[model samples]
Target: MKTLLTITLTSLLTFNIAFAQTPEERGLEIAIESDKRDTGFADQLAEMLMTLRNAAGKESIRKVRVKTLEVSGDGDKSISIFDQPRDVKGTALLSYTHSTKPDDQWLFLPALKRVKRIASRNKSGPFMGSEFSFEDITSFEVDKYTYKYLRDEEVEGKATFVIEQFPTYQASGYTRRIVWVDQEIYQPLKVEFFDRKNSLLKTLTFHDYQQYLDQYWRADRQEMVNHQSKKSTTLLFNNYQFKTGLTDRDFDQNSLKRAR
Candidate 1:
């Protein structure tokens, strides 16, 4: 009888420990697990078509080529080069994202033959006239935000854990973001961004996710809608090639000018 009593007490203690976990702890655990599953993709290359729609329903399209290099112990490095539309052609944006520091971004304007650095204060502004801001384009790192688990709910037929995350970096445009992470795949299905005023600013949704190398999941389509401006931007991604032998040199400032 004593042995059985001790067993029961141990079980109860274990259950209580798990049930006592704070929301913040659970949120961080989820984020860590999601990040762990996506690790080890050396590099990636893809073609993208960006469509911008204004409140008046006016639409504009741009073609772009994207290259990314995974950085161990830090955030990834990425470079985007405009391909089509003669006016924006040869324009490139290079970014060096860090886990806990202000990200470095630069735009190379071929027409002006100069590289303009993106100031930290202006990171909140729109990127290339799109609804997505400069702060939105950077690679997501776990340490960049403090998280709190909100609740679990179904999002578009998938069970997801809704968590709220506040950016830890300086000069961020958003006060907080609520993300719906798919429970099965450990990837985000939807995100709602709140502005510095703590008002709902934008909603971003991912669609048609395809897995690469049986590990990484890539969203084929992403839509970002600005609630205040009534404008939206849709990114259609295609021709995804992973582990493309990309290197640090490919993401450097010099490579931005040479991108073709």
Candidate 2:
């Protein structure tokens, strides 16, 4: 009877030990596991940003600036500008995407006679003379990449999910990318970029996140560095407003020329 009781006690202890997990450990697990399921936070995030509409009851403005550089490998050189609100009061610079195809671009430069069109076909050329190709800038949308969970680790004191995102678009210059996302905020902290040859090309870091409208989060600054060239670009976001009555007409090509 003593031997049987001892055996039963051992079995119960084993079961409890296997089932028990601390809250932090559980949170970590959930955080990591969530990355493995369909639609990673990266995709969700991009979709959220793209689909975001100006809220009806809010009035606000956003300001943005993009600075570009040309690396040693390419002879192509150019700078582009864009603005939003399609009016004079608000100056929300939208995007400065670079390409070889006449540097496909639209600018709202108040000084210019009209919104200029960029039509260059150097698709494979480096952007701003940096290691990053033009394809990188035009790829802010979420549907461009497919994701998979790699592992979990701590980054800057917070448990994080390290996920690998593969580009789905045919025109992309990258083969894959690894991103680190904070478990609590679901915000991407860092990204490792890989070229078409599957080699490390660059690194991107996001910082200074601030909450807006109690539910929305925005990164105040973002920096991207080329591993090979040692050159980088830093983007700053200022005066961001949500639900600010933006319309489809605002994104129109004809409106570009008239933008302030």
Instruction: Give lDDT for model 2.
Output: 0.52
Give the TM-scores of the predictions, in the order they appear: 0.93, 0.56
Which tens-of-lDDT digit does each residue in 1-260 have in candidate 2? 99999999999999887678544354445444443331211211111011111223222322323322222222212223333334533221223333222234554446545554444344446643443466654433344456666778898887887878776555566788888877777777888988888999888888888876565555777767767655566555665554444444454555555443
Model 2 stretches with alpha carbons more than 4 Å out? 1-142
Best by lDDT: 1
| Candidate 2: count of backbone clashes, pairs at least 3 residues apart or interchain | 20
123-234 in candidate 1: lDDT tens per residue? 6778778999877877778998999999999998999999999999888899999999999999999999999999999999999999999999989999999999999999
TM-score, predicted candidate 1 vs. hidden true structure: 0.93
Superposition error at 206 for model 2 (Å): 0.9
Off by over 4 Å in 1: 1-13
Deviation of model 1 at 168, angstroms: 0.7
